[model samples]
Target: MPRTAPAVCSAVHKTDPDRPRRAADGLNLCRGCLKGMHRNLSDLPWLHAEVVTSMPTTRATGSAPVSGSRTPGLPVNLRAGELHSQMGHDLRTIAGWVAKDRGIHLPVDGRVGSVCAWLAKHVNWLAASQYAADVRGVLTELVGRAWAVIDPDRRPMEVGPCVELVDSTPCDGMLWASVLDVGDPRPSKIWCDGCELELTPEQWYRFGRRYEARRRMSA
Candidate 1:
């Protein structure tokens, strides 16, 4: 038999049955609703358990459960101001030193609004700790470095061709060059300026052999 829906007070009459229903007075909520609410709460310490775990041990305060004892993994519905306060406190205590050392003067007002927004833009929140660490390392290297001063002409070590390849070979005299624009997970398109020909993988290999032979004969 289908169970009858629970009676809701007039104030909460507009709420859907599936969503978490709470008493108008904020007293007791349905068990299912409470669970859903708990999961959805962004302030829950468990949501950040992975982050907390990767933090340096020296930052530990009192050794109790990092989130709290009463609701170890439970979520807490925190207001925007409260969330900002917590983040500000953490960044000031932990990241302030590094920022100062790098001559990036973070505000001392204990409100991390600007800092948090900056971090959100650069770092992927869902990435693993090791990935985040690598990103931090890169950022640290960029400290005090002017973006405009960095050489834009330099190319990446790994470049790909724009077309498919069947086979290839290397010779001492011929350079294995790829198109400047192609990227990985895509085929490479290579052409030889000397022959004014678009060289397939096999043809490129032959060109390399001929170039090497000519070089050896000249020597």
Candidate 2:
């Protein structure tokens, strides 16, 4: 019998339809995606703590210096708080699902670190399960959100100028795409500063083709 082609990865980040798929032991996710998901789960707890420490009030750990003026310091970072809360919730929610199915008991205290540890131990199994894509998406999203708080200035790759048409003219915005770190899920962000145009992964190929055609026409 002829060998069947490997099934494409169903992970959310695998949006590049032209990319080749690799076999993954009959798992829903490819090996690279599975590894990235595992790494994200392992890093979630650390990222959660780092995001908390990134908050200005948390870092100060004391009352502000008296400046002899009635003024408010930086407003509390509600976004950071939300990220921290959501991280714990996501970790525990996934862990709870796994625990219920595997007959494993979660820690009574519901510590995020303990939950992360538990998830780390079972990530491989989780990657092979039917819910692999969902698990990967949740873990990757959590890690990405935490990274935004911890390192908002992550380096970007220049992707030439914006090729988006505005009233039959090309927008003059410079485009930059997010650079992915090792073990990061495939990055799909491509944005233009001048026009504030953002391209989804599905549009990247067509955008590139149009950009090259425009360039050749000018030359």
Best by lDDT: 2
State the lDDT of candidate 2 residue by residue for 160-213, as single tens digits: 766666445555556778666778665556766434366776887777787799
Instruction: Write one digit per residue (lDDT tens) for candidate 1, span 154-179.
Output: 21122222222112311111122433
For candidate 2, what is the lDDT? 0.67
Candidates in order have lDDT scores of 0.32, 0.67
Residue pairs in steric clash, candidate 1? 161-187, 161-188, 161-189, 162-188, 162-189, 163-188
Off by over 4 Å in 2: 1-6, 14-20, 56-74, 151-219
- Local error of candidate 2 at residue 112 (angstroms): 1.9
Candidate 2: the clashing residue pairs are: none
Give the distance in Å from residue 107's predicted Cα in candidate 1 to where it truly belongs.
Answer: 2.6
